[model samples]
Target: MRTHRKVLVLFAALASALAGCSSGPNQPDTVAGQFADALNRDDIAAAAALTDDPTRAADSLNGLYDGLGKEVTFEVGSADRNSFTLAATWNLGPDGKNKWSYTTTGTANDTGDGWKVKWEPAAIAPGLDIGPLTYDPVYPKPARILDASGGELMTQQVVTLVNVSQGADTAAVAALIAPLAPGLSAQSLESDLAAAQGKPITAISLRAADIAPVQAALETTRGVTLAPQTRLLANDKSLASPTLSGLDDLWQKSTAAATGWAVRVPIPDGTKRLAGQDAQPTPDIATTLSIDLQHAAEDALTPIAEPAAIVALQPSTGNVLAVAQNAAADAQGPIALTGLYPPGSTFKTVTVSAALQEGSVTPDTVLPCPGVANIEGRRIPNDDNFDLGQVPLHTAFARSCNTTMGGLAVKLPADALTNAATQLGLGIDYVTPGLTTVTGKVPPAATPAQRVESGIGQGQVTASPFGMALVAASLARGSVPAPALVKEQPGVADKTPEPLPPNVDDQVKSMMRETVTGGTATSLRDIPGLLGKTGTAEYIDDKHAHGWFVGVDGDLAFAVFISDAGSSGPAVEAAGRMLRMQR
Candidate 1:
């Protein structure tokens, strides 16, 4: 009876062990059913809470559903106390027609009361299909605006090296590297390399080791390499140090205009700062300048071998039309708008206007012109070195008689002349797009001689072709529009222009018309409806004269000035060419 009791006790212990092993339901659906119910109702939060590692399970489900082309269903393949396996079928979309199958395995840990599923996808199944795989493209950035209308223009750029080797002779290496790095400053490059290495690199000699990491990084990240012998040093071998110096000098002048525009650059990943980097590349500016017209203007005036300036603008819109300065032969600096010279006889228009506005004289007023006129103990002569006996104000202007203009200058108070010049946009800084402009001085109030000369477009009086063109433009539109390089912006487009009184503009227009018709600028007769004025301003030494001509057609206004060149003949010729081109 005792032996029977021992067998029964041993059997009972064995039964208890087996029961613990098989304690979980035969079907793993118990937990899976709850997870499926939550998923079927689109309750991600509930489904996530039911698992031991809900966060991981939820993330996996999110990734899977995100990539699924359709809806899906789950099935239990097998189950045990510690683990379970599931098979799933998904419909690509809401239609639930297209389907895909994936097999997943899950493991459960014994909780105090029951089994709780661990949320590891890898542990579940080897061939589980989470979803389609995707990766970022190698070249994922936007393309840059390379060129406008496919024409070569001046541009700037910064240069740098990746995975370059550092050596003791870094400075020497940089010197050798200068020519290969176009638009990059060697000093700047050295500074950057020094900072990158966390110490001063007096010299750099790159070898295979220094480049390995950079090469590896690029290859791994960008899937590309620096091509063999693609280095710039070999191509620039023939360039001498002096040549580099000359290039540096030119860059300074060209970059001066860069202050007028904004620059854009791409920020690559892992780039911390641009500090100490090589000088950035300079971008080319697309200007309103007409290269063909500029070349022609240069050719036409250079033959006379004189300093000159010319500017053309649309009368109605104030768009700069064309400009030419000193001849190409004598090419100095950019002469388009910065050249300053005396206005000479051209200033008579300003004097005459002042006189009319001050009620000192009118177009029909008679003025004494007996060969010469004495004013403030000085004799002022006409262009012929003498003046006509007595002539109407208009006739005096037409003949460009200096004596009459000098007499009128004395009669008109200095303030009147100053006000007229100021109203016409002179004696003030003039800023324009993509170009530098000279203010062109006018005589100050303190000096009588300066004021007299200023009245006659001499002495301290100076003006650019750009300013003169603006004067003509004022006459054309009964106002002046601010000159611009880019298209005018909205809201403030018309504000740039300053208006003149209607009567004043009309009188100037009539006089300008007479000038081209039969007066000083008869050369412009071929240009129908053209109105213009010519000036032959004399310098103190009388060695050379500055020639000027300003004119206007329907909606275009232009001015030309030739420096140290006698007479306005060449300027007139150039103006005619420009006018024809415009037509």
Candidate 2:
């Protein structure tokens, strides 16, 4: 028994000695854990203290963190008495989509009083060489914005960049160039040239097509140098510039550092796009625009010096055929599809539909048409307050009798216009990947006057040119055809079509045709099968009105608009021009 007790005592002593050797105040794993915590917390001084070359390693870690960008987290993956590995993940702010993750491993050894990392470049990045590193971001060729006919609406085009070097006359150079590109300001060019650094003077970048009209004159101009550069853009004076500008933003966002981040390599030329090059692969998204119709719509707005927009749609398919906006309207951000404005008397189509459904009026039903009628004590007047005493509903609509329409509003519910507008594909709830639109707005009325106003396409009744075109399309097709700009399988059409009252479509069609024959829209008489409504919508203040024309001609249905046009004459003229061009 005494011998067994002695053996037990000896084993306990050996176990204690082994435990002592295995752990200490400066053990490898403990040191590594502290280092990782310090690194993660950005405690440069504390982390440096744990390394052999304190200052150098801390500086290295600082550079590493700086390269990692905004957010980064660190963890000690594996640790032991002699070795440890750390895993780190970094996010380069919102500007970068991808996160970078890498693991760093290093050895640890006892140095008299404590354990320290055998610091080396590999401990920061595996196989990292001598010297600082730089990140070079690479950009891909912007994708082409194509139309339904597979025609490129916005494509890669060459442009000329004019530069004024040392001792050059900025005014003379700008004067020569301004005639070629009207948007370019000679005074601004002179100012820019005066403030230029390495490059003497930089002028506006002119599209090759824009400069072609006066290439002869530009060649003869003095004190300037021109260089050809390539970029994605629309044709000169095209309405697709806003769309292209949006695409350019996407391209900028898609850019990132190239793979296998290097210390030294020749950077690639950004304009060597994969679009036309066989050496690389990229994307080109297809949309449902029509280049031919888009140009026709642009030509239609040529005569209107004010801000104007025109949109065209295929009635059977609801595909957007064209979206064109005059230069004066471009600042409004693709107003053809996104601008919201009161529809004015053009909204009577919806009001009539509601009235027919509610059994309040019919084509044969005769209604009041005084020069001015009072609805709920609010006075309502027709266009120029022209009275057509006691006319049929059909004749009243054909003549755009606002006073007569106002009478029907007093008989219907507040949501009547809202429901009718929704049923007609206005204010449709939908989302397209790379498209924008404002369907329409028909808010419920709080007062009889408001309801009467809504009846005449005023008050809360609003629409974009795109939205008005859809309403015209729905009336022409006898059902609400879904509108789409992208090739979507079960897209806008999948939305429930608003049921129209029986023969209501036919009645409205007849009245619209009558509008061209002997009504307010008589300007469209020369356009065969042209059935339409003309509106001069009052907006902003008393005298400011917007011109609106919505119509259907054969397979086409469209809307034209001109801001502050006072009357629909300009819109009608633009519509006529579009029809003639399309024909």
Candidate 3:
């Protein structure tokens, strides 16, 4: 029994010794645990001190921390008296978009009096034998803007922005760059500089060809800096300047979603790819514009001296085919899509539709075609007061008899014109992507005088070229269509109008055809199946007028507007030119 006791006591002593070895301060696992804890807390000094070579370890660890963006997590995967493995994960970028994780193997050595981790670069990451590590990001190519037929419209181009600091040499900078850019002057630069309030103002952004001649001189100028920026620009600036400017925001959004990044090591020649993802660009953005039609519209407006614009749409699909404006029109902004003006005789179409819907008059009903009539104290007159005694409503409409339309309007309900205009897509608000538009306003007329004026489209009634185009489209399609610019993003209208009655639609269409055939738009009659209306809207006074013509040829609906044109002849001629090219 004494011998058994002695054996058990010896066994107990041996177990206690093993336990002490595992938990003692000199144990290799204790050093490994401490090293991992120091790394977790980002204590580079403490972690390096626990390594065999403190200086070398500190240098490598500092580089690792910086290269990994200072966001790292270290966990002890396996640990023993002499060997250990650590799981390291790094958060490399914002929003947790980039992460790198790997397991590294290292050894702990007993240094007679203490235990320390061996200094090896592999302890930080697998296959990492160098002193420094780097994270390199790769960006994808920007997406292209495509037309409805998959033709490229806009692309990423590099442009240099010339910025002037608060104390910059304004005179010298302006003089050097003024000739390169149009409409820039030294006096204007100084005035703009004073308004900057100590902030740097960008004088201009120039294409590569525009700035190549002065690039060297501008770079040396004091308080001036040239910054290169990648921007989405039209492949042909002359095609659709106003419409293409609206697509920049959408282009940037698509590019960001497909951006890719990578981690790489710097070599003597260039960079050695380490771990990364290759950039894959997103699909091209498809717009509703037809490039061929856009070019044709632009070409047609080139001969006009006044500020003229043209807006075209596909009546069947409500796709915006073209929005073109001449240089004279560009100075006034995107007037083709947003500028509101008195619609003149173009609104007669709406009035006639309203009259037909009320059953007050059919296309065959006889109405007085007086040259001038005092309807509720408002003097309504035909073009040049030319009278054509009692004729059918369709005949009076085709001839654009204002007195006849005013008489019909004064007899109907107050909200008749307003409702008709909305049904034709003039008053409804549209939220279309890649385009900002204003469809003009048509207010309800509560009195005979107001109705007479609204009926002839002269008072409190307005429509944009885009709105007039929609009117023509509605008549052609028998219903109002939701407009769209981007193929995938159809516009949402604020209100859904009821479809036009079949009888009303048929009657209006027949009158429009008669107007082009033998009415005010006979000039465009050469084009087959063309239906149109011409307007000479008086603004401010009777002396100056804006010319307008809205028409539909098969599936194509368009509006041509010329500011201060004095008559509708110029607008009709421009429309003829535009339509002829499409054929």
Model 1, range 177-225, lDDT digits (tens) per residue?
Answer: 4454554454665566667685433232223434453445433432122
User: Among these predicted structures, which one has the highest TM-score?
Assistant: 2
Q: Give the alpha carbon lDDT tens digit for every residue of 1-583 in model 2.
A: 1121111111232234334445766766666667766666667689888988898887877776565443556666555447667676554334544455678887778887588877776665543434333333334555676767776666667888776676566566666677766666766765666677546665667787667765666566666677788776764444653345544544333332222222221234422211111212346656677777878888888777899999888888877777788888987678877888999878888888888889767788988899998788878887778989989998999899989888898678988888888777787755544456677888888788889889988887889888899899989998887666655622443357559867888888898899899898887788777899988899887589999999999778999989999988899999988888877
Residue-pair clashes per candidate: 28, 0, 0
**What does candidate 3 score in Cα RMSD to the true structure?**
9.4
Each prediction's Cα RMSD? 18.3, 9.2, 9.4
TM-score of 2: 0.78
Which residue pairs collide in model 3, if any?
Answer: none
lDDT, candidate 3, at 543: 91
Candidate 1: regions farther than 4 A off: 1-287, 290-296, 326-330, 445-449, 489-499, 581-583
- List where candidate 2 sits over 4 angstroms from the true fold: 1-24, 43-49, 54-63, 77-81, 91-104, 111-114, 130-142, 156-232, 235-237, 241-283, 489-497, 540-542
**Model 2 / residue 128 / CA error / Å:** 1.2
